[model samples]
Target: MSSDFQNVVPDTEHKGLVGLLPAVARPFAVLARFDRPIGWWLLFWPCAWGIALAGGAIDRWDLLLWLLLGAIAMRSAGCVYNDIVDRDLDRQVERTRSRPLASGAVSLKAAWIWLAILCLIGLIVWLQINGVAKLVALGSLALVAAYPFMKRITWWPQAWLGLVFSWGALVGWLAIVPEFHWAMALLYLGSIFWVIGYDTIYALQDREDDALVGIRSSALRLGDNVHFGVLNFYLMALSSWAAAFWMLRPHWLAIVTLAPISLHLLWQVTTLKSADGDDALAKFRSNRFAGLLMFLACLVLGQAG
Candidate 1:
């Protein structure tokens, strides 16, 4: 990988596919971040978690597939919108300077058209869900629309991202289980902390560039205590998850299901190299698997209870 391509953040997997695209379509593909499946995976996990923990994993397999498609389309749309809004800021940051919009590979008008296309796909997925889930998913639009500007005004934009990205949990829960439960709220809350923790790792890659460009991030905010901050954030995530499990099952054994993910997160914190941008990126990307582990935990508890 060249220095330029490294700017793509989690440039670990399937990146070679982008190189095979034709010049005309390559910019749009990059703009949508289609090469980086990690974003959609992160988005999809919370939705799956919601469905599984809400006791819809088996009969709701169709809904799971539809929601997965929705995550991909909407995550892509959000990236295009963010690029359109933050083209200037993206250019100032070396890590993002090569992005389609910032590099002038894709014009703003074309990006908007592509964003609309992605949203069309998202709309199709949205229509497949129940009215309750539709309304719940729709509520996330305001948070998504405002995300690009968050770094400009707030040091804790990651918290806002938590609210935005973790919203799929709510939608997934409502898809089949519309009844309110404290377990659902606790699951969503724990997911917020999970997002904050992983995104802080992602932010580590841009710390220097962000400082130079006046873009705020939790990684920058925590400074040298980044390790400690993420540790606590993940701890909060596990504790909240444990509490959620208790609410659903009231069994001590349910907490045991969380051990794998808890250990995985501890591994991430224990071995993280804060000064190594690439290491930080690898740690952040590892959450895809962490999300899987969480789904397994949710599956166990959801089915058992």
Candidate 2:
């Protein structure tokens, strides 16, 4: 790999376990993205929001931990699967060209084996949840399986990712309540928009390469108006969340808890440099904090009674 390609593989330089692991294991770690925790954090937050907003997370903290573990494992599995499917495309993209599969650091057979191991871990975590949650979680597999192909088939792959990533909210809620409610649905929808917005930001890093490779992404579709598009998505997300909160608590103050997250998102849009990959990535990674803020809002609102 060229030095330029090496520089662009996200978080490859992070001196985490991927760095400390023996050289043989490093490629697997890279393939699974253990060195880049932002992906799992993004996946875990909606799960936390659902649990916290349903009033069970405070007491059943073990459930939150299980979901977190599931997020890490499943996100890794999803990445491995995506890399396997997109290996050709990955080799063409500047940022992803150095990825384990594309760079031939990990063989396809080994990648498949690693994916199975990650899914096995996810299965253990899934089994710890309630039967309803188990069923709900299982349903996400179809969405997950279809996601890697969305870029080839549609211009709105980020939208499909929103649906897939935000399914965890439903699973988390059903894990505790075992009953469907409008508030949970609204929360899930809100999270879908949230994923769309952040993933759009993430896609900005690849827009040029994506265009050259004929991969469709919201960032490429939006063109120069990407900032405005992100603002609209964030506004929609906040609106859905506000409605969910109002439905759950019906108190004027319950909606106020979202203020911090709303402001944080505002800052992200306002400060975003749409053309700078580093700036785009910084804003994208900052969603981890955004997730924490949203989780805190849910925790407060869920405990309000």
Whole-structure CA lDDT of model 1: 0.91
What is the C-alpha lDDT profile of model 2 across 75-143, one tens digit per residue? 999999999999999999888888889989899999999999999999999899999999999999999
Q: By TM-score, how accurate is candidate 1?
A: 0.96
For model 1, what is the error of residue 89's alpha carbon versus the real structure, in angstroms, after optimal superposition?
0.7
Local distance difference test, each candidate? 0.91, 0.91
In model 2, the runs with Cα more than 4 Å from the true position are 1-8, 11-13
Pairs of residues clashing in candidate 2: none
Q: Which ten residues in a row have the lowest lDDT in candidate 1?
A: 1-10
